[model samples]
Target: MKALVKTEPGPGHVELVDIPEPACRPDIGVKIEVKYTGICGTDLHVLHDTFKNYPPVTLGHEFSGVVVEVGSEVRRVKSGDRVAVNPSTAVVCGTCEYCLQGYYMFCPIRRGMGHGVNGAFTKYVAVREDQVYKLPDHVTLEEAALAEPLACAVQAIEELTDLHAGDVVLLSGPGPIGMLCLQLLAAKGCRVIVAGTSQDRLRLDMALRLGASLAVDVTAEDLQQIVLRETGGIGVDAAVECAGAGPSVLACLNAVKRLGRHIQVGIIGKEVTLPFDTILYKQLQVVGTLAHSQKTWVRVIKLLNQQKLPLTDTITHKLPLSRWQEAFDLCERKQGLKVFLSYDE
Candidate 1:
């Protein structure tokens, strides 16, 4: 089996290596023949050595595949079943308070797949059976590959604030997660304003096509002015910062209404300075969210099954495993929105 292995620390240490195929552990794990795996922002972090990742490991966490073998204890899926994987929590200490309450990501000893262990960037991967979700018959494998990211978006929305119909939302970044947030908020009847810089022109345009009420170019136009005008002198009910940039965070702080919620969904690699006085004066509710929960995955699958998400356009490029460099380059250059690596080729 050929896998994209992060063989060492430091930048760009990844390579395509011929690795032994993973064997299913009876009564615990299942072997999947991976079909499509999406390259994510986190993968880029891994390449740059900014994110925590184990070396000599496969490098993809978002993927969909067909089950080739199932452990004896895995009755949820069987051989030949199509499935999407939830890779956030591969191992957890059940005795931890967070784990006991079903918040496995909060468990101190938790080790996520693709980072803490091997992932699905190969022809085959052996994952714990509990991490697999059987895809519906109507969902294509390509669409299912988006489940992991969509579930993260779902968690962001559900855990952030109580969004009501007709509420105004200011979404920053317009990147993959930001775009997904735009679609999810729009579907809930929120009038969303998607904001980004000049580099995100195409993504901002896509946000409008996907149902954002407005798209603001933060570099050229005043985002605060647009929010005020759109909200009739009031600020947006909630703001989601997904760009992971300092300026974007400041913009969200300025655009959100008094007593409104501000959700930080992006992963900022370094510490950022924020306006503490504004948060205090406005009595703002600030929340920081992590990865998706099991419940979020269930909701994401339902949304996909219902054909509610505009997902086809999100996937702009697909390349073979051999062309992984090209795929990574496209993503890093912002030339495409959700670049997928197909193993079937």
Candidate 2:
């Protein structure tokens, strides 16, 4: 089995090597044949050694595939069933305080699929049966691969913020997560303003096509002034920071109105000084969420099924596992939104 292994934390350390294929642990979990896997921003960070994790681990969390073999206790799925893998917390003790409250990610012993254990970047992945979800018959494997990041965006916007209809939403980024947030907020009937640098024009255009009220070039527009003027000298009702850049985070904070909600979805690699006074003086509600919950996945899939959001455009590049390097380069160059690696022959 060919799997991209991270030998060490440096440029070009990732290599495609023929490794032993994962075996089905029927007593413990199910083995899946990965059909398609999407490379996420986190995967890039992991490759760059910026986001530290277990060494020598497989490098993918967003993937979709077919059930090859099921564990003994896994009765919900069988061989040949299409599925999407949700690489979130696994083996949560239901009795724990966080687990009891349904905050699985907060569980002290929570183990994620890709970060803590082997992920879907290989020919086969053995995951807990509970973490697998059936992909809709109408959905393609490529679309199923998006469930992870889209679920994150859904959780960031729907669960973390208190947004009202007709309220303005200022999204400061045009990456996949940011574009997804733009679509989700527009579906909620909010006026969405997507702000990004000139380099992000392609993604911003896609956001506008999805439903954003306006797409402002960060270099050309006074984003804060535009938001304030559009909101009748007030400001946007909510601001979502989806770019993991210090300036984007600052812009989001500045665009949000007084007493407004701000959701920080981006993961800035390092600490940086921020304007705490604005938050305090305006009585702003600043919040942050790590990853998606199971409940959020359900809602995000539902939104996809309803045809209210079109995610296919975000998938601009598709390549085979052999071209993994090119895929990484494309993502790093910001040439596309989501790049899917086809693991199936």
Q: Go through the candidates in order and give the clash count of each.
A: 0, 0
* Candidate 1 per-residue C-alpha lDDT over 78-141 given as tens digits, one digit per residue, 9 for 90 to 100: 9999999888877787798887776788899888878788988899988888888998899999
Supply the global lDDT for candidate 1: 0.88
Query: Which residue pairs in candidate 1 have backbone atoms (N, alpha carbon, C) closer than 3 angstroms, thus clashing?
Result: none
Q: Per-residue lDDT for 1-345 in model 2, tens only?
A: 888777665654777777788878767477889988998888887788777657677788899999989878788788898888778765577678877776788888776665566677788988878778886678877778888988888888888777878988888888888887887888789999998998887887888888999999989888888887899998888888988889998888888888988899988889888988989988999899888776887786786566567777789898998899999998888889899887737
Candidates in order: C-alpha RMSD to true structure:
1.2, 1.7
